[model samples]
Target: MVGKFTVVDGHVHTFASEEVSGKILTSFNKLYNIEFANPGTGTITDVLQNMDSVGIDFTIMANFAPAKIIHKNNSWSIEVGKKYEKLVPLVSFHPDMEEPMDILMEEYMRNGAKGIKFHPMAQGFDPDDNRLESVYKMSAEAAFPIVFHCGRVSNARLNNYADIDMIVPVIKKYPNIPFVLTHMADGNIGDVFKLADMFENVYFDTSIVITGYPPLLKVNEPSWPDNEVVEYVISKVGADRVIFGSDYPWGSPGHDLNRFMEMRIEDRQKSMILGENAIKIFKIKSSI
Candidate 1:
């Protein structure tokens, strides 16, 4: 365990090849000039090694659909997750794709995918579009969590769609589905944290929280996140709703955990943020 806490990174991605230009690797290059030789060190094998070194027990192998490769990427995640018991694969699809609800239903029945992730800006859709109703309802029925890219990034064209305001209505509509707002709203974190206070099912992930934010945050230029904002959010939403996530390969999970651990809070709270919250939300079974 990482300093007496059983660790789990709730948000991480897999790259079958360095040529696959998804945000998982692109963000790393854009934020830091460090390059991978290929997917050799960023694929499932790489994740396993990193977890072993840093004391991470398991990770959720998240997915993001990049329009052209929706099916191939989803299948890759499912198959990789099967290869390793530590990786929990998430089903993903573009909201605007044809018959996505049917696809998700079939994938779940066939593969037993328990959770899903979405990148609204990457997929080119409104975050709260009505077209997602059937899929959201299906996930709600299963009590599956939906991890949404609720913040802007360097590669996205329309930055406005990931705003928390646009998706609050949708979050309200689906109470059963544990809706996780990723990247702490990507710098609009304070506002996003307030939303957590309003919804019981709402949760927040500290993935890129340690790195750069818009208007000036950079991966090469590291900045300590505002402790005041974090303390305030924890006070407002309580530590139970916050989960630890290292946008693996893009940022360090250990760094993210250390950021929270350095905060002046009770140890119990830190433990929840590190792993308990994710285990409870994702229903992660003990890998030990």
Candidate 2:
């Protein structure tokens, strides 16, 4: 209803169990208490309906389920992919686990995970720390890209968390691996712009920035509006270096998909932000 082009929401999470109550609040203070024992809200049907209603053609859905939690829920993400052709699964792994890298590759990835996710803030690790090198190496070897959580930690204190500096070295060392920085690095726009200029394998997702972050960070700013941040990053990294992200369910409580589409951008640029750019970089098929 908003635009003719097919859209790709690069980020969304599914809860594992519907029985145990876990509260997740957006930066805006909107809270969603998830029951781990029950069925997930972002089921295959729910994803299809939401995408169809929003005019989105495809989505890269991600999830994190610890062993203590309903670890089996992680499989549901792959299930969503099976149930809906448009859904692509991004799998998660726990860092504290030993050689978890091998497990991810042998099990989740071989099964059909399109990408991997790293929650430095929530997952409790620094993206740049040497400890994650194994994880990065595995992802690189698999030729799959990784999405990282970047920005201020509202949920937890991650040692050396939320900075491109921590992860930049890894990106530099493993030039072949693709790193996707989510939340625009959580206001690390300048560093992100630099990385786009520096590495061909690095990418940034534009999600929830317009609302989750303060006005100063908006890419569509009037003078050098927040959109300038978007334009600058695009200029430095090239349009392909940037991908569209909603930070959905969390960022969605305040920002709507239509407003995200309506931002100040040229038609072609909008097309890239919506879905085209991601298709090229991730090698994902476009519904268009």
Candidate 3:
């Protein structure tokens, strides 16, 4: 724990192998025209080591891959969570996959999946697609929390797939399922506030937006929220609805944690954002 706080990283990505991690990083470099720092290859071992370095007690594995390989990636994520006590796995699913939703959910739940991770932009599906109604219905019945990559990626070919509007319907329909929108819904902070005001089950994870993108030298201008902006957001939404996430590999856990700890907020709010809120929202049972 980080001095009286359990410090759970609400969002992180893990890869099956170092090669895949390297490739993903390379793609990001090409897209952003900047070299990312050595964030330890995005492997399970790398993630655990980073967590230990930063005093993060738990990390939710928010891994996602192309639809063709999603099942395999999710299976690996589940196995990793099963083997590591501190790693909480949130598997990904696409409605276009050949496997039926019921069968896939059964397999994922039977194998110890903690929740679901959806990246409509990465997986190339619309969040409000009619095809996903079954997925949402089943998730509601099972009460699975879904962590969404709810903002646009830098230099992405398309951005509408995960837009706030695209996700609003599902969030409204599945009130039983906790929906954690990552990156403070990135470019949609206004809508994010509206959603937080409207739905008690909606949550916002402070990932890249809270600390800005990593390796400060690469950024042309300060694109993230300032201390005042962040404080205002927390105050408006209430500390209970904000979660701490490092967006590991793309962002540093150590740097992000230190920055957050230094924010001009009360110890009570810091404690909530750092870990307490995530634990309650994700339904984590580990003793903090």
- Which candidate comes out best when scored by TM-score? 3
Query: Which segments of candidate 1 are over 4 A away from where they belong?
Result: 21-41, 154-157, 211-224
Q: Can you give the lDDT of residue 215 in candidate 2?
A: 32
Give the TM-score of each candidate: 0.84, 0.78, 0.93
By lDDT, the better pick of 1 and 3 is 3
Q: Write the per-residue lDDT of candidate 2 for residues 185-279, one digit (tens) a residue.
A: 66555676676778888777876553433332333221123555555556666666667776544444124455555566667776777787666
Native-vs-model 3 lDDT? 0.81
Q: Taking the tens digit of each residue's C-alpha lDDT, what string does model 3 give over 1-288?
A: 898888999889888788989998888667655545655677888998888888999999998877788888888898888899799988888878777777888888778887889989878898877876777888898888898887666434465888787888889988999899988877456877899989999988887777744564255232354778788888999999989997787777788788877789999999999999888877788765
For every candidate in turn, the CA RMSD to the true structure comes to 3.9, 5.3, 2.0
- TM-score winner, 1 or 3: 3
Residue 127 lDDT (model 1): 66
The per-residue C-alpha lDDT of model 2 at residue 237 equals 60
The worst-scoring run of ten residues by lDDT in candidate 2 lies at 31-40
On lDDT, the candidate that comes out on top is 3
Candidate 3 wrong stretches, greater than 4 Å: 32-35, 155-157, 212-222
